[model samples]
Target: MARVPTDSPARRPFMTAVKVMLYAALLGLIGLAVAVSITYSQLPSYQTLTKTNDLGQTIRMRAANGQVLVSMGPSVGKWIPYDRIPQAMRSAMIAVEDKRFRSHIGVDPIGIARSAKVRLETGRFSQGGSTITQQLARNIFLTNSRTFGRKIKEAVVALALELKFSKNQILELYLNRVYFGGGAYGIDAASTRFFGHGAERLSLGEAAIIAGLVKAPSNYSPTADVEAARGRSSVVLQSMVNNGFVSADVAAGVSPAEVKIQKMTRQNNVRYFTDWALPQLDTLIDETSEPIDVWTTLDPTMQVAADQAIGRNTPGGAQGALVALDRDGAVRAMVGGRDYVDSIYNRSTQAQRQPGSAFKLFVYLAALESGMKPTDTLVDEPVTINGWSPRNSTRTNLGPVSLREAFARSINTISAKIGQQLGFSTIADMARRFGITGEISTYPSMVLGTSDVRLIDMTRAFASVSNRGVAVMPYGIRKVVSANGRVLYQHDAAEERVLVAPWVAAEMTDLLQSAVLTGTGRAAQIGRPVAGKTGTTSSNKDGWFIGFSSGITTGVWMGRDDARAIAGLQGGTAPARAFHDFMVKAVANRPVEQFETQVPMPDWQLEPGEEAWGAGDNAVEPVLDENGQPFDQDPYVYNPDATAPAPPDPNQQPPSQLPEVSVPPVRQQQPTDPSRRPAPAGSEPADDPSQSGADLAQ
Candidate 1:
C-alpha cells in the first residue's frame, strides 16, 4: 500500500466513494438554493393589505338617542400616534413583552433559542418567544391554532409587517392590538380602567402595573386578587430597574403602597334600561340591513326617579315595574324591575296579570255607550247571576249609588251589574277596540278584572284616555340613525278613534278624577288635576295604580312572579305611593292641567207616585200574549205602583196560558227586581203608593 498505483482495482472502490460524496454535496447545495427560491416566490403580499377582509369583525350594536345601549364585544381601539404613548409605559411594555422589540426584524432568534432551552429543561412548552411585531401579526392576520403550520404563517406575516411598517408603527400596532382584562382590548382602555385616565397620562408605576397584567390577567386583575396583583406589579418594576428603563433609586422609592388600584364599580347606570331598549331598536332597524342608533324619548331624570321610587317603596321579595309615557304615547321612562341584572324579566312590558278594578274603565265606557248617564242610579247591593255572585272588595254594599260614585269606589257588584246590563259582549268589544289584546271572557265575572292584561297595553290605554280618547300606539324609539349619521328609520305616534263620544270620555275622566281626589287613589293626587285608579286583584295577588296628567301617564304594578299575594300590600299603599313619589320629581316644573269637563245634564221633575228611570223604563210592565199584542187577562196587566199588588211569578204559570213579551221591553223590567231596587231619594218611598200618598197629602 506504500506505493499503491493511482489506478489500482482495490483503491478504485475508495476513489469512487469519495467522488460520490462530493457529487452529493454539490447536488444538496443546488436543491437548497431552488427550495429557497420557491419559498420566497410563494410569500403572500400581506404588506399591501393593511386591513384584513374578514367577516369576523362585524358587530351588532344598539344605541339610544346617540348613546350606546349595549355592545356585545370590546370596543375597537382608536389608533394613536406613537408619540401619544408615554415613554415609561412604552418601555415597560417592551421589557415585559419583548426585550429586543426595537432591534429585531420581526423575529427574535435569541428569544426563540432561550425559550427552546427552557422548554427542554421543563419537558413542556411553558414560555412563548413571540416578539411584539409577531403578536400583532398573529392577532391581526393569523389563526390562533397552536401548531407548526400556524407558527410558520405567523412568522411569515410578522416578516411582511416589518417590511411594510416602520418601527414606531409596529410598536403602536402592538400596543393597540393587545388584550387587557375587564373587557379592555388596548392600552388606552386598560389605562382608563385601572387609573380612570388615558394611556398618555399614566404614571410610571401605573404603567408597570398595567404592563404586568399581560402575563396573567386573571391572576393580576385588581378586581380579582389585589395582593397577587401587587406582587406581579413589583416584579415588573424590578424588570424596569434591571433594564435601565427606570432609575434604581426611583424603583426603590416606588412602594407597592404607592400603587393605587382603583376598584371598578359594576356600571349600574341605566344597564337594565339599555338592555330592554336594545332589542326594541334591533326590531325597528333590522329590516333596513343597516346599523342604527335609536334616539328614544326617555328622560334620564324621570327614569332615575322611577327607579329610586320603586327601590325605596317596594317591599322585600316584592318586585315593581313602572312606565311613564307622554300624552302622545312616547315612553318617557320605564323601570322594568328592581334589579334587571338579577332578573332579566321586564315586568313593565312582559308581565301580564288581572288588572282588577283598573279594568272598569272599559266597563264604564260600555255603560256610557249603552245610554247610561254618569248620574244614573245603580244599586250596589249583593246580587247573584247564574249562581255566580260577585262581592265588592269592601265586602259591604253602599246601597243605591250614582254611576260616578260606584265607579270611583271601584265596586265589584256595581261593575258586574253594569257589565251585565250592557251585555258582556259589548264590554269585550270595547276592550278590544281599546287595544287590549288580552282574552276577555263573556262572563259577568270579567267585569271585576278576571281578564289578564299586560302593563304595556294598560299603560297605552291610559295614555289614549289622557290624549283625549285618541288611542296612540306606544313606541320607545323616535328615530334610528346609522353610524354615518343618516336616518335609517323613524317612528311617530299613530292615532285611531276608539271611543264613540268625546262626552263619554270626559265623563270617564271625571269619575277617575273623583277616584284620585276622594277614593283609594288619594296617594296619587298631585298638585295638579290627576285622574287615576287603584286596583287590587283577589287576595292582593296584583297591585296596580295607573294615573295620568295632561303631560304624562304613568302606570305602576307590584307583585311577585309566583302570583303569590304580598301580605299587607295594596295598590293604594305600595304602587300608588311609588307613583306619587316618582311623579313628584318627574313632573317638576311641568305646568298643571285639568281633565276635560263632563257634559251638562238637563233638569227634570217627576209627579207624585211617579218614578223616573235611567232613560230605559218608567215602571214595570206585564207580560204580553204570543200573538204580538197585549192581553186584558189578570197576569197580562201592567202595574205602575208597587203597593197595588204583587205581580204573579211568570215561571209559576201554566205553559199554555203563560204570557210572552218582547225581549227588548222585558229587559227593562228586570232592573226593577225587588232585590235590585235603588234606594229612595230623600228618604221618600220611590215606588210605594201608600208612603207616596202620605207625603203628597201633607
Candidate 2:
C-alpha cells in the first residue's frame, strides 16, 4: 500500500486564488464582448425626426380677409435655439435631469453603480441612471416599454447619440422632446400654455417649475395642483443651488411671489373651434391629398362675442351652439358648444333636432309660390286629416286670420295645412334646394317642423334667403399655405339659384320681419332690422332661433345632451336671447342697413265663385274657392281673368213661357235646433263627440 502526499494548506490557498483570478478575467472579457456587440448592433446608424403628417399634426383656420383664426398642432412642441434657452432654465434642467450633464459622455458609470446599489437595496425601481443623452435617445428612437431589453437598447442608442451629436444638440433635442402637462409637449409650449409667454421669457422660478414637470407632469402640474407643483419646483431650485448651478443666496432669497404664473386668459378657448374645423379640414385635405388652405370667414371678435353670449344665456344643464355667416355663405363666427374641453359633441354641425316653427318659413314660401298672398285669409282652425289632427300651440284657433297673422303667430294648424296643400314632397324639395342636408320627413307634421336639421344647414339656408335666393355653399377655409409659406390651394365661392323667384324670397323675408317685431322671435330683435324665426319642439325638447341681418346670418340651438327639455327654455327665450346678444356685440361697429322691403300688392277684387281676394294679385293670389275651400280647379283652365264676360240676361228668356203656372203656398220649414245636426259624414268624431257635433251643427 502506498500513501499519497497531501498538498499543504498554504499551497491550497495560492491555487484557489489563482483559479478565482482566472474566472474573473474570463467573465470580464465575456461582458466586454457582449457590450461591444450590443452597442454595434442596437445603435441606430442614422436618426431623424419623425416625418410630420401635416393633416394630423397642424391646422390653420383663416378669416374671409385672410386672417388666422386658429393655429393648431397635435404636437405642441416648438423648437428654440440653445442660445434662446434661459441660463437659469438650462441650469435647472441639468440639476433635475442630470447633475453631471456637462462632464458625462452620454453614460455615467458612477451614476449607474449608485443606481444599481439603490435598486438592489430598495427592492424596487427607485432610481434611473440615464444621462440627458440617454433620455433623448429613449424619447426619440426607443419605445417606452420599460423592460430590460429596452433599457439595454437605450444604453446602446445613448452611446451612439453621444458619438454622433454634440452635447448642445443632444440637450436641445431632449428639451424639445419631453412632455409637459396641459397638452404641452416641450418647454416652449409648456411656457406658453402655463405662463402665456415663450420659453425665452422664462424667469428662474418659472424655469424651475417647468423643468420640474419633466418627471411626472400630471402629478406636478401647476394648473392641476399648485401646491404640489411649487414643492417640486422648490426641490429643483434647491438641487440647482446644491450643484453650484445656481447661487445658494439666490435660491434661498427666492419666494413664491417671485414666480409669477401668467393668467390663462382662454383656457381651452380655441378648443371648440378646433374641434369643429378639424374634421372638415381632414375631409378636405385627406380626400384630395392636395394641400389647401381654408380661408374661413371667421371673425375672432364675433366668435368671442358668440361664445360669451351662449355661455351667458344657456342654462346650467343646457348647452348652446351658434353659427354666423356672411351674405356670401362664408362662416363669420361659430361656437360649436358651451365647452369643447368638457364635451366634444358639436351641436351646431352634429346634433339633429326638430326645427319646430322655424321651419314655417319654407312652408310660407311654398304657399306664396302657389298663388297665396301673405295678406290672404287663412283659418287657424284645428285641422284633421287621415287621423292626424294638429292643434295650435295656444290650444285655441284664431279664426279668419291673414297668412302673415298665422305665420307671425306660428299657428301650427295653419302651417300644417299649408304644408299639406303644397304637398310634402314639394316642401321637401324646397328644403333640399335651400341647402338643408338633413333627412326631411314628407309628412303633414313636417310643416310645423317635425324634422331635425343642423344649425349649420339652417344658417346656410337663411344666408341664401339673405343673398337674394342665391345659395352659397358654406365653407370655413379659404386658402391653404405650405409649411414653407407657399400657397397650396384656394376655395372659390360656389353660388346657385335655389328659389323659384327672387321676389318670392323677398316677400318671405318681409313676413319673417313680423316674427321679430311681434311674434315668438321678438327676443331676437336688435336695433337694426333683423329677420328671424323661433322654434320650440313638441315637448320643448329643442330651442332654436335662426335669423339674419345685413352683415351676418346667425342660427342658435339650445338643448340638453340627453334630449331632455330644459326648464323654461324656448326658441324665443334662451336661443333667441343668445343670438341677439351675440349679434348686437358682433355687428356693433358695422353700418346698419335696412332689410329689402317687398313690392306693394296690386289692386284686385274677388270675382264670382272666388274666395276673398286681395289687391296684390301680382304678388300672390288666393288659392281658395267661394266656399273657402282649397281651389280644386285646374290652374291652366282658370287662369286668373280680371276681365271676363257676364252670363246672358234672364229677361230674354221670358217670351218663351206662355202658360201661367199656379204656385202652391210654400210652407216655412221649422228651424231645427242648431245643436242637433250630425257632423259631416266621413269626419272622425272628435274626442268629445257631443261637443264636436254641436260645433258642426253651428
Candidate 3:
C-alpha cells in the first residue's frame, strides 16, 4: 500500500515490461488481419463460378420406337437448376444435410457448438459441423480429407465463398455439384438415377432418401444395398420432420416402396440388352460428349412373350435363357436371366453351355453336306472311335434307321458314327460357318455335344438353317443416331450368304420337321408346321430346344447355375414346352404360313431305308424319259465300294424297343402341358455337364 514516488527506479522496470507487452499484442493483431485478408484474396471470384465446368446433364437412351429407356452419364442427369428444385426436396435436403443452412453465413457456429457438446458428452465424433455453404466450398474447391489444417482451409474458403456469392447462389452450387451416390453427382442426377425422373418430380420419400446419401454415398447406394439405403432414408425423414420440413404423420407414413430407387441402371426390363449393347457403343463411334440414340431390333411384344414363356416353363432353382432372331438375323428378343439385378452375366451372349442334342443339327447338316441323304441308312448302335464308345441316351440301339429318323430321335450312336465318318473337324467347320464363334471340340463325343457355345451363336446358326442355309450373323442394333439427329451408325443388314446351298437346307428342314412331328420336339408344335430339336444333357444338367419358323428362329436353354441336375427335367420337356408357348404368342398376330417350298416333300415319310411311306412321299416324283426310265438322278448316289466308315450296328433292334437312356440326347417323348413345369429360376445356364462326356467314352 506504500505510495510509489514519481520516477522511482523499482517501478520503472514493471512499466517497461507492460509497454513491451502492448507493442507485441499490437503487432500480432496486424499480422492476423493481414493473414485473413490474404486467405480471402486467394479464393476464386464469384464471377468465374458460371464459367467453371457445368458438366451435369444425363445421357439419355431411347428404344427403337422412341420409348425412353434410360438416362445416365458421368455424374449427370436432368439439370434441375436451383430455381426449379421442388420446395419439399429443398427443405428435406437442408434438414438432413445442414439444419442451420439458412441462418448461417458460411459456417454455422451454433451447429459447431452443439456438435462439440455432443462429442464431448458421448466421447464420439458423430455430427458434422459444416454448413451447406461450407460443404459446397469443400466439394467444388477442396479435397474431402479430414484434418485440422484442411478444416481451417474449408472454413476460410466457405467464408470467402459466402462473401463472393449470394446465399441462394451458394445453395444452388451445392445442390448441383454435391455427390449423391451411384453414378449420380448432383441432386438432379441423384433424382433421376434413383427415381427415374427429374429432380422437380421428386416425392417426399425420394427427396429424403437422396438427401441421406450425402454423408456416405456407397453405404446408402440404393442399387448396391437397398436395406442400408432405406435405413439411411428413414433417418433423413425423421430429420425432415424434426426440422419442420415435413409433418410427423407424413414422415411416419412414408413407405420404402414409395421411395423407389432404380434397382438396375437405366430401365428395368432392357438392362441385359443395354449392358450388352453399351460396349458396342464405343466401338461404333469415337469418344462422344453428346449421347447417341440407338435403335435396336428388339420386338417389345416378342421380348415380353419370351420372358413369360421362360418364366412359366423353367423348373425350380433352374436358370434359363432365350434368344430369338428374325430371318434377317436381327435379334428380336433376348432374356439373359430372370432378374438382372441378381446377376448381370448375359447368358444369351456370354454364358457357354453344352447344346446337347440341339448340336446335332450341325452334325446332321454335316451328314447332308457330306453327300449323305435323309434316305441313306444309318445304324443306331454303340459307336467307338479311338477307344471312345458313344452310346445312345436311350441305352438301346435301333438296328437300321434313315438319317431323318436318327436325327428326330437324336440318336447319339448314329450321330457319333456320322461324325467319325465325316470327321468332327467337318462338323465344327459347319458350326463355325453357321456363326458359332466359340471353340468346338473335334472329339467323337462332340457329335453328342461335348463343346460349349453361347445361346446367341446357337440361335444364329439355327436361323441360318431356317434361312435356306444362308448363314447369318446375329445383330441387335438397327441404327444409332446422335442427339442432334446425325446418323452415327446404321446397320447395313445385308444378308451374308455363308452357307448357300438350297438342296441341303431343304433336306435339313425336312429332317427337323420330323423332329417336331412324331419325334423328340413334339412339345414344340404350335398347332402349325413347326420344326425344332430337343436336347437333354448328361445327368439332366442342361436342357435345350432350338428351332425356327420361316420368319423367326429361337433357342432356349435350362439348367441350374451350380450345374445341379433338375430332377425329371429333359430338353423335350421344359425347354420344348417353353419354345411352344413362346412361338404360340409370337405368331399370334402374324399369319401362320407353311414353311417355304424349299423342300420338295415337306412332309415326306420313309420307313428307315425301304423308301416312301407317307401321303406326300411321291409329290415330286422323278421325271421318266422313255420306257419309264428315271432321269435327274443325284450324282452322289450311294456306292458299295465307297471308303466311307460304316455306320454302327452294335445291337440291331426295333426303333420302339430301343433302350431310351439319358446321355445328353434328343430322347423323344410326348411332352405334357407346359403348365405343369416349375417357374423360371435364375437368368441363364452355363455348360459344364454334371457328368463328364467321358461317361459315354467309357
Q: RMSD (Cα, Å) of candidate 3? A: 14.4
lDDT of 3 by residue, 1-698 (tens): 98887579988988899999999999976764565567678876655663425544345555656676666666666445678988877887898888887777788999889889989999987988889988887877777787888888788778777777787788777777788877777787787777788888888888878888888897888876878888888888888888888898988899866666675633455677777766677677676656667777777788888889888998989888888888888877888887677766678889888888788889999888776777667666666788887665445565777676677667777887888889889999988888888888887778777688888988887788788888777777777778788998888867466594776887788788767654677677676667777777778888888888648899999888887788867777888889988998887777765654234433332334443322354333443556776544331221223342222355965343222322111212223322211112211121223323564454
Worst 10 residues of 2 by lDDT: 681-690
TM-scores for candidates 1 onward, in order:
0.54, 0.55, 0.60
Q: Give the clashing pairs for model 1.
A: 65-294, 65-295
Candidate 1 lDDT, tens digit per residue, 1-698? 58889899989999999999999999976864564455445545534332323212223333334455545445434545589989988998888888888899888999999889988999977989889888887876676778988786677767766776788878876676676765566788777777777887878888888888887876786656767777887888888888878898998887766778776665443555555666675476655434445677777778789989999988889889999888777777788889764665788888888787788889887887677766567887888766677765445576877676677666777887987677888988988888899788777677767678888788887777777677867677777676688887788546466555566777777777766654567677556777888777766677888988757889999989998878766677788889889998988878767566454333443445553232334443444667767534222112222132133455874343222222122222224223322111111111111211121122
Assess candidate 2 and give its TM-score to the true structure: 0.55
lDDT of each: 0.70, 0.70, 0.73
TM-score of candidate 1 versus the correct structure, residues matched by position: 0.54
Question: Candidate 3: where are CA atoms >4 Å away?
Answer: 1-60, 73-181, 186-267, 596-698
- Candidate 2, residue 294: Cα displacement in angstroms equals 5.8
Off by over 4 Å in 1: 1-269, 286-292, 599-698
Kindly list the per-residue Cα lDDT of model 2 for residues 272-361, writing each as its tens digit: 555666567655554433334556657778888988999999978888999888877677777878876555567888888777778877
CA shift at 298, candidate 3, in angstroms?
1.2
Quote the positional error of residue 136 for candidate 2 in Å.
16
- Root-mean-square deviation of every model: 18.2, 17.1, 14.4
